[model samples]
Target chain A: MTVPGTLYGVGLGPGDPDLITRRAARLIEGARVVAYPALAGGDSFARAIAANMIPATAREIVMEVPMTPARAPAQAAYDAGAARIAEALDAGDDVVVLCEGDPFFYGSFMYLHARLAPLFAVEVVPGVTSVTACAARAGLPLAARNETLTVLPGPLPDAELRARIREADTLVLMKVGRHLSRLRALLDAEGLLDRAVYVERATLPVERRLPLAEAPDPAPYFSMILVTKGADPWL
Target chain B: MTVPGTLYGVGLGPGDPDLITRRAARLIEGARVVAYPALAGGDSFARAIAANMIPATAREIVMEVPMTPARAPAQAAYDAGAARIAEALDAGDDVVVLCEGDPFFYGSFMYLHARLAPLFAVEVVPGVTSVTACAARAGLPLAARNETLTVLPGPLPDAELRARIREADTLVLMKVGRHLSRLRALLDAEGLLDRAVYVERATLPVERRLPLAEAPDPAPYFSMILVTKGADPWL
Candidate 1:
């Protein structure tokens, strides 16, 4: 008999169907229910990447997770979302929560997991992080021997931003959407502006890479900057 | 007609057959010639992975790569390996050089790539990194949001190692073979020894993880340590 109240947090990988791990694919395909967070009615990247692995007859639940910044409001939204996921687990169904990239790497799925892991069985399947994805897409090494790799979110204070860039051989600046211009100035002051490569939606259908100095605002949160020594390999 | 004198660096994705990316699988399955790095006499994880992706009829070339501390000898080994790959591409055959993890992530495949990419046509397909694979196997997040993730080689000077341990939220110590004991002492001094997880032969058939205190010298070069909260998730 199948175990009840079980949850599988599957990593859909970096927006490619084939990149899904064999174990993740199996859990997803055999799942009695599958849930993925969505911004709206449109298809989510996580869902699309995991589209192939999901079986035809499984129960598909597109959970609408609200993006709220406030503590109380966000907690309410998370509670409601967790309730929906719990409903499936309570029904004795094996539910697979599909997440883009790794589930724990700044991903929103952690909320649902934190609420449920203590009361139920939970397993997280790791996927490729965007740092590795973009580095590979750019045909460059993330870090060489004796090199330090640091991943800093773009919203950090100017001091933190400058410190991270100056402290490592390689730095991946995530959340570069609205802060591209500020980061560009920071990199310029640090003398790393010339070597930085801005990659947006790396490994996705609309993936693009350009020099960070020329990158204007309007990039997405899925974007990142891979700054390393050496010229762009594609050039 | 296929272009002559073009090379492809394909990511083998850890050591599992199923972890190979779909793009990598298509390229390998379609390639006229497949090449992979081997220590000697042909047995290699990269080749075994690519072999599972392609049909039985595909041609194979095993490039011998000898890792040496001397710069001159290593360069010669890379030069010879690149030359062997050039032969297949010269015949108007699509050649795929399979590499473990992402091609540019600390693997010897990058050496061959550096030699051939300038003079020949080249394409690189990034796959799942071993860090990600090992993280998946352990079911732990490598680093969370706002967490400092530092990947060091474990042979760093004592002061540098101590500083890294003090500042990072999540630290991954790679290339840890016989230096395990010294590392354990350092972590103990930093009060992180109990929390450290040591993994050997990550994602391979005999992969195993031990508490930092119990690790003997059975681990190899490819092994790693996932130190949770190496960097504080939140400041």
Candidate 2:
């Protein structure tokens, strides 16, 4: 009887090859099969980050998740991806699924984890998240002492975003691609424009960091705005 | 004229040596001078995380930061440490200050960065945080889509903590040291005890994960409670 193999969801930290953990690097190099998600027709950022470390002889599984607001298409893609990974596991081949940032923090790997965890042995290797990456690049300390840090998506409604931003001691607004203009206006209204720092492609060669006031009109999907309210708590 | 050496704030990730990034490992291995904070009379968590990677030839700087509610003692310790590091930098030897988690996210390195950044070249290498580590160990997806994630310090006043917990879509209560019983009671009051997962010393050999209701009282300072309201968002 062949023992089923374990599925490892490996996090390749925010687009930096050097940021990959030693554990994740070793896993990628030793895996018999590797899996990652790609945009419907675009390249895989996760795979690209770990490209140098992945063994050339290992088989690759690419799940083409559609870039759409509707959840069904992406869910279907993950469903398909999970099935393929299960097949590999059943065949006693350990599969390493690459995830951008930490696997359980807003990562697509969670979708597959939901489906496959019940039947297979799954482990999550956490990675450096974009929140910390942006903070490091922007030279900002997120929260200190008893301060509260709030993370919100830019696509959220204005009222909710405003209330949360006002309540938060430090804020990280993520998925700021199409919503950059509106998010800027909202922050400006809350008197937080000067406090906000916009960062995109953190830890990468082409990374950009500027005050939110000077950010590009249409920021990239990977962009984020970090705002630390009031005085510097650490000081 | 000798060029003053750059100060690198390297994040070692949560406790596991393997979780350290390749960049951080490389920095530690090649470093000539290393600095880290230690409890006034105790061992340094940051140093222990990267002890294996640190070169035998490296000179160590231990800053004995007194663990007190008053900030004056710790600040003075950092001031003294920064002076020593500055002297080394003036001598043209790069200093690597080891940080246990992402340096910019509630890390002690931020204090040093604030003190030395004005006079020296300082760069922060981001690493996996305990928040993500706890999430991964507990198999909990932090936040997805438009959900708001609020991170609160468990030491906050009861009223403030209760209000924030109620308002948050997903909550991560950090610094769950002496407040474990109180936090558990608060969560129970909000009907969130079942939804909360307690994780302590994540990724280390001594890591513990359990439901909040079953967690031990007097949890360590490294402990955290992750609570996700409502049904599984991914499912």
Candidate 3:
């Protein structure tokens, strides 16, 4: 039984229902109301991932989160939505906010959590993050001991990017769709492009992988670039 | 849909069969053989997580990694395991090794990868590392945007530990069950002992969470401590 005055921030796992942790599933199934963020497009893939697990009788609330890269107006929109969640908790309605990965790992759920959690008791139900799921799908390890693994968002300064690439033995560059060509070049400049792999919508049923040179249409914004210094250690 | 020369390394999500990513599941189901490292106890948790996913008739190879703190014997055992895998691939079988969490995070997979990868096609699948999962399970975010997050194993010089705690906004101390008292003292010195959370077997069915003080028999290993400096942003 849940203690009073509590909110659960649940992880949906990366766009796959079966990937939800059993704990997350139980929480959602029994939650008084299951909350999720959506855009004008409606129920997001991440939301759908966990929706199947929540019983049909449970209330599903789609609090919109601006999907476009956040600028002034977008941030304003997120603020407004977070306010809606706050209003819910005032009525003693417990919420289970569905996030794509571990709610905090580069997912949009943080915004909602930030806004709603302050006045309410909050507990995070961690789910598998996409990086792990991607690596799992790729059948690759994140790093070897003392091998140094680096996680670089696509927007870092090129020098920072290069230094991370030079320093780490394994690198998982996230949000690289827009920066694919630039990242590809960086890898090539470092002579490691041939060792890179592209994973698009990893762990999703529609997932696919390819050599860095052969990836189709440079992946969606959800794509990542995984590079290794030596060879696949498990080979 | 077989790729002639490529080998896939799939990481099963830590200890939970249902937590395995859909793509990891797909690959395992399709692979001709599945391999996993076993310790003294047989039918490893990693293997158990992948069991339902693999083909019913697929070959299962077990590489026994020693269970000890020693180095050389462990290294040699990994070398032998790598040799056996090499023999399998030499026979033209595509092998998928099930690692509990991203194999490279901390495991024998890295040793085997180093030994066999250069000579054969290989891939590393990442799994839910204990840190991210533990942090999430504990209802804490690892770090905010600019806050430094340090990942440290126990047994570091006290000086290094102090420096890490001083620099990082979020500290994930791994291998701490045995070293609990030392960690407790360090956090106490930093005035964070009460705020610290001990997470054991995070995301698994039997996962447990308690304040550092509640750990009656501090486990010295696999347990993680998440120390957060920011006002609970998601609280």
Model no. 3, DockQ: 0.28
DockQ of 2: 0.77
Clashes per candidate (backbone, < 3 Å): 8, 0, 19
Tens-digit lDDT string for candidate 2 (B45-139): 99999988889999999999998988888889989999999999999999999999888778888888888898998889999999998988888
Interface RMSD of each: 4.0, 1.4, 4.3
Task: Give the clash total for candidate 2.
Answer: 0
Candidate 1 residue pairs in backbone clash: B168-B230, B168-B231, B169-B229, B169-B230, B169-B231, B169-B232, B170-B230, B170-B231
- Candidate 3 deviant stretches above 4 angstroms: A1-5, A30-32, A67-75, A86-93, A214-219, A230-235, B1-64, B68-72, B75-99, B109-127, B143-219, B225-235
Task: Give lDDT tens digits, candidate 3, residues B1-235.
Answer: 4334456666676566655655567778898778788876574778777777778888888877676767666677677767777777888887888877767676557666667777888876555567777766665666443333455666666886776576555667777866788888888998888888988877677788989878746673557787877634432
- TM-score winner: 2
Q: List DockQ, one per candidate, in order.
A: 0.46, 0.77, 0.28
Highest lDDT: give the candidate number. Answer: 2
Give the runs in model 1 whose Cα sits over 4 Å from its true position. A40-43, A230-235, B230-235
On residues A189-219, what C-alpha lDDT tens digit does candidate 3 reach at each position?
Answer: 9998888989988867788788888876555
Predicted candidate 1 versus true structure: per-residue lDDT over B90-183, tens digit per residue: 7787788888887877666677766777778787777777777776677556665556667787777778888878877778888887778888
TM-score on alpha carbons, each prediction: 0.91, 0.98, 0.71
Evaluation by lDDT, superior candidate among 1 and 3:
1
List, residue by residue over A123-180, the lDDT tens digit for candidate 1. 7776666777787777676666666677788878889778767877778888888888
